[model samples]
Target: MPARDSIDRHIAYWRAEVPGLDPDVEGVVTRMQMLVRHLQRRRTEALGELGLLSWEYDILWQLRAAGPPYQVTPTALAIALDTHPATLTHRLDRLTRAGLVERARDRADRRSVVVVLTDQGHRAWESAIGSQADAEGLLLAPLSESERRTLVRLLRKVVLASEKDGTELMVVPRSVQRPEH
Candidate 1:
């Protein structure tokens, strides 16, 4: 398992110490919260070494892996990244200047623009993939193969459930839907 610190040890302590709680939410929800913290911290650190923040890496990686026009509308991009228009606009502006991402006319909607990954961005992403794999392997090394499959199955159930609370996860649709236009 990846090195555990005092923070990991104390997470359960704090969970148990919550002053008042709903039984159902307190279990799975709190565990998810703590797990997210652990995951994000390591992910940020691991991804940072490549000189790319998670959000920036995420945007570029999505565009590159899309494997076609290598372009997507800003709205569609925002949905993929779980970000807002203003936030996407700001990041795109930065990436555009860095020559990592480019803005091009959207053939589908003349009024809209699309983000496409540039050559440099694709090369950087290729270099970063190894680091990303290393980080993910370390993060998940604790579980056995069967346990990993079981955990993924259980998490998929929660992720696909309809949202009752308006939370950050609202950005992620219960399932990606493709409708004929």
Candidate 2:
């Protein structure tokens, strides 16, 4: 009914250059990759407008998700964020200066430290989350409700397959696992 998008053109080009090429496979993979990049760019722009880096917003959101008191140890945070402790420590410094977070010694363990989300930080995190959701919704607005549901289900199938394969093929390190209560 309408002209195809760039991925369609890519499939056509590949078909022309390499006979027997599987256009269906190539098209789906290419489209999925382009969609991911588009979503990432949208997220980056939304957070950047609020003066928050992606990593900063993610860390803040993680702390916020932890609920009441809104605090977690740096190690726990590092595991949740899938980042190095040193990198998170550096980010914590910037967050602290912005008054979004505060680091204090643990009362029960004098040698330990804990990170807490300040009220301002909670507000910023909420604002960022709202903006990010709006941006994502706008991106998906072109799709019908049924289309969205179908897309989500299909994507879940692919993701679950990949995750299962990954779990079978790899072993997670202890440091990356969630901390025990």
Candidate 3:
């Protein structure tokens, strides 16, 4: 077995299988991993600026951008984020206590509840979003305008492909019911 860092695995694989492959693959992948780590750390810092956790920001952002009324069931958030039902409920409870969101019975179905953002929640979310965008922009500043556009298109294709049918596409104002065991 070759030592982990011995000739780069990416280079070895491509060189062995395909002829005249670009050498940038190893450099790109390694740089991407570094960028991802740095971005995740900056993301945590950015969200914390609004006194919110990563999960908290995700939920609020989902509701706000989810179109008019900006709300969706906990189940929907879970599915979109690939999280569990129990985990989503716990997060909802935390957000509710912070007054960032509220859970109310769905008018059409008494047994069902919807999580809605409050006024304070909206302001907090706006602050978080602005900071995040600024941070991400700075992170990508190294890339030229054309590079940025190309990167965005490539990344979006990968993201959309992975999530295509993983969750309901509808933007709903209601959530799945959670009854105590």
CA lDDT of every candidate? 0.76, 0.86, 0.79
lDDT of 2 at 179: 62
- The deviation in Å at residue 25 for candidate 1 is 7.5
- RMSD to native, candidate 1: 5.4
The residue-by-residue lDDT of candidate 1 on 1-181, one tens digit each, is 8775555555556658875645546556666777778778876876677688888888887787666667777888888887998999999999898899999888888888888889998887886777767767877898999999999998877776744454555443333333549
Steric clash pairs (candidate 2):
none
Task: Report the lDDT tens digits of candidate 2 across residue range 1-181.
Answer: 7879999988988899999989988989999889889989988988899999999998897788777777888998988788999999999999999999999887779799989899999999989989878978988999999999999999888878888745632333343345669
Stretches of candidate 2 off by over 4 Å are: 107-110, 166-181
**Ordering by TM-score:** 2, 3, 1
TM-score of 1: 0.65
User: What's the TM-score of each model vs. the native?
Assistant: 0.65, 0.84, 0.69
For all candidates, the clash counts are 0, 0, 1
lDDT of 3 by residue, 33-123 (tens): 8778888898899887778999888888777866656667777778866789998899999999999999988677888887888898999
lDDT of 1 at 4: 57
Candidate 3 displacement at residue 13 in angstroms? 17
Model 3 CA deviation exceeding 4 Å by range = 1-22, 153-181
Highest lDDT model number = 2
Q: Clash pairs of candidate 3?
A: 73-175
